[model samples]
Target chain A: MKQENRQRLAGAAAGLVNGLFGGGGGTVLLPVLTRELEGRHAFAVCVAAMLPMCAVSAAAGMWNAPPDLWQAAPCLAGGLLGGILGGLTFGRVPVGLLRKAAGAFMVYGGVRYLL
Target chain B: MKEAILTFLCALVAGTLSAWGVGGGTLLLLALTLLLDVEQRQAQTLNLLFFLPAAGAALFFHRRNGELDTAAVRRTAIPGALAALVGAGAAMLLDVDLLRRPFGLFLLYAGGTLLFSRGKGFSNQRGEEAPPTKKTQ
Candidate 1:
């Protein structure tokens, strides 16, 4: 398959997983992005790519069963603050360590969800 | 107020990790269900919603840092978005509980790859790969 085609395919799969699973598209997109982009750039770029995917997923989820925004307000507020901090930290961190940490988080998620 | 405070803190942690381009939504879902006793589907929905502004904020910083790849975004966003609709449809059809184990396994596989892949180390957008930590030390 052509490279662009593979990327689009992965993008579709990433979106589907993000939509179906309600996030975690990064885990899927990162591997693909890393091949084309540089290290830290790959991680940052994954977020860029996943943005619209998450939006579509969020909208679809709401359509099926609208959530109370009131319930989400606090989480959003905190997330906004944290996003700023994490973004600031993104460029400074070592990619190798970041990679390992992401892996560890996935491992943790695996265990948490499995139980 | 107490419940709200707890929820905010949990999201703060998740959001921070997420902005780093990792698994913040997973953390948020886990915290909401395990710590706050939220129902699974609701937590999942909340997680999707939570990602938007958080992602926007992170994107701004990444753009400023010159870390974002606009070309890459342009290439992937549309397909990803369309597929998201399909994914959401799938989520709606299945029981939320059933997705957990599969999602869990997926995470483990991805994580293990990340942990051990020995892919290229971190580099700046200028294409300067950072020297190893030991070398720097």
Candidate 2:
């Protein structure tokens, strides 16, 4: 497949995941982009692309959300701080460790939902 | 108070994951749905909202480090954005329970891939030798 076609497909896939699930587009994009781009570069592109995708998806689906501002506020606040921290520590932490942690979290989430 | 604390902590974890350039929203969704007993639809909604700031922050850092490819961004953003709207509409129409089971299975699949694969996809932070590059025609 042509490079342009590949990028478009990756983008569409990323967008679909983002809009459908409300997030996780980057995870989907990372592998696809990695085939054409460098590892960090692929990640960067995924991150940048995700911003607009998330925004559009969120706006489209905002009406579906239950009115629960009080419940959401704390999580949002904590997430902001966590983002800042994660940004600050981005390349500082060991990638292996982070990957394991993320994997563990995903496994736990999947099992929890399954049961 | 306890609920508030848990919410904050979960969001923090979610944010950190987002910053790592993975899907922090999945973790956030899991936290909200399982830990907080939030309805599946509501948790998904909150995950989308939470994604914005976290992604913005992560992008800022990635940009500062000169990691983002502007040309690629331009090519992908519009198509991706349009598709996202369609996807969101589809999700809104789907039954919540139906969505949940498949979503869980997906998470498991994704997690298993992450755990077992030796793919160099997520090792961005390590200063190890870069993976062999493929020349794009």
State the TM-score for model 2: 0.90
Candidate 2: deviation at residue A7, Å? Answer: 2.4
Model 1 TM-score, 2 decimals: 0.85
What C-alpha lDDT, on a 0 to 100 scale, does residue B83 get in candidate 1? 87
- Which pairs clash in the backbone of model 1? none
Q: For candidate 2, write residues B53-77 as lDDT tens digits.
A: 8778888888998888888887777
RMSD in Å for all candidates: 4.9, 2.2
Candidate 1 residue-wise lDDT, B1-137, digit = tens? 78788888988878887876556776677678767987777787888888887888988988887777676676778889998888899899998888989888877887787778663543432355433332100
Over 4 Å off in model 1, which ranges? A95-102, B117-119, B122-137
Question: What are the per-residue Cα lDDT tens digits for candidate 1 across A6-109?
Answer: 67777888898888888778768767766666666666777888889988888887777776666789888988998988887765654557657767867887
What's the lDDT for residue A93 in model 1?
55
Model 1, C-alpha of B96: deviation from truth (Å): 2.0
DockQ values, each candidate: 0.55, 0.64
